[model samples]
Target: MALQIGDTAPTFSMVDSDGTLVDLSALKGTKVVLYFYPKDDTPGCTAQACNLNENLDYLSSKGYRVIGVSVDSNAAHTKFKKKYNLNFSLLADTEHELVNKYHVWVEKSMYGKTYMGTARTTFLIDENGIITDIISKVDTKNHSSQIH
Candidate 1:
């Protein structure tokens, strides 16, 4: 089932782009923007990541810690972050645990062929760890303002 607003976000720990282990529980009491994208360095994903990066100040001003997640390796995340100067942390869900927990993994069709992939989705978790909002149909550009 898709995650819903008011549900406690599934807690998971994974390596960040910096290769440091980051636990979601450690971020308690801070509004969080946890986005799940399909991959790193792809056009749509890059645009979405950069859009958020460009509006970090506004997000922070509203008390949110923006974090992106994908089924990518830490090394891949590092390169992607550096390539785009992304200010947010990207969690590497190599095992797909978080992806499954968040229900972003699903059937996708490209060129009329079905495939398993992440559905570009974003969640707004409140300070208390409950999901405050969910944006399943994310628009890559102007995503930050769109969320707010």
Candidate 2:
């Protein structure tokens, strides 16, 4: 089933690029901007990540913490973060756990070829863990503005 606003966000515990454990259940009292992207360092993903990073302070001021999820390895996430000086946590969902749980993994079509990939999606979860908004068509360049 597709996740919708007011549904409880799926809980996850995964290691981030910095090797720090990020557990969703542990962040109960904090609002979260949970985003799923295709891959680390890709053009669109990079733009989205950088845009969010650049506007992180504004998002933080609104009491939201950003967390990015991808099926990339921790090493790849580390390199991507270092390359862009990203300040938010990039969770390495190498096992496809988070992607499947969040239902972002889907069949995609490009150039007449069909393949499985992570759909660019964002879930805005409130302090109590209930999803407040779902951004299916994300604007990579102005993502933060779309969040509010």
lDDT (tens digit, per residue) of candidate 1 on 1-148:
7778899999988778887777779889898999999999999999999999999999999999989999999899999999999988899888989899999999999999999999999999988889989998899987998777
Clashing pairs in 2: none
> Which model scores highest in TM-score?
2
Poorly placed runs, candidate 2 (over 4 Å): none
In Å, residue 18's CA in model 2 sits off its true spot by 0.3
Model 2 worst lDDT run, 10 consecutive residues: 12-21
Q: Which portions of model 1 miss their true places by more than 4 Å?
A: none
> Taking the candidates one at a time, how many backbone clashes does each contain?
0, 0
Clashes of 1: 0
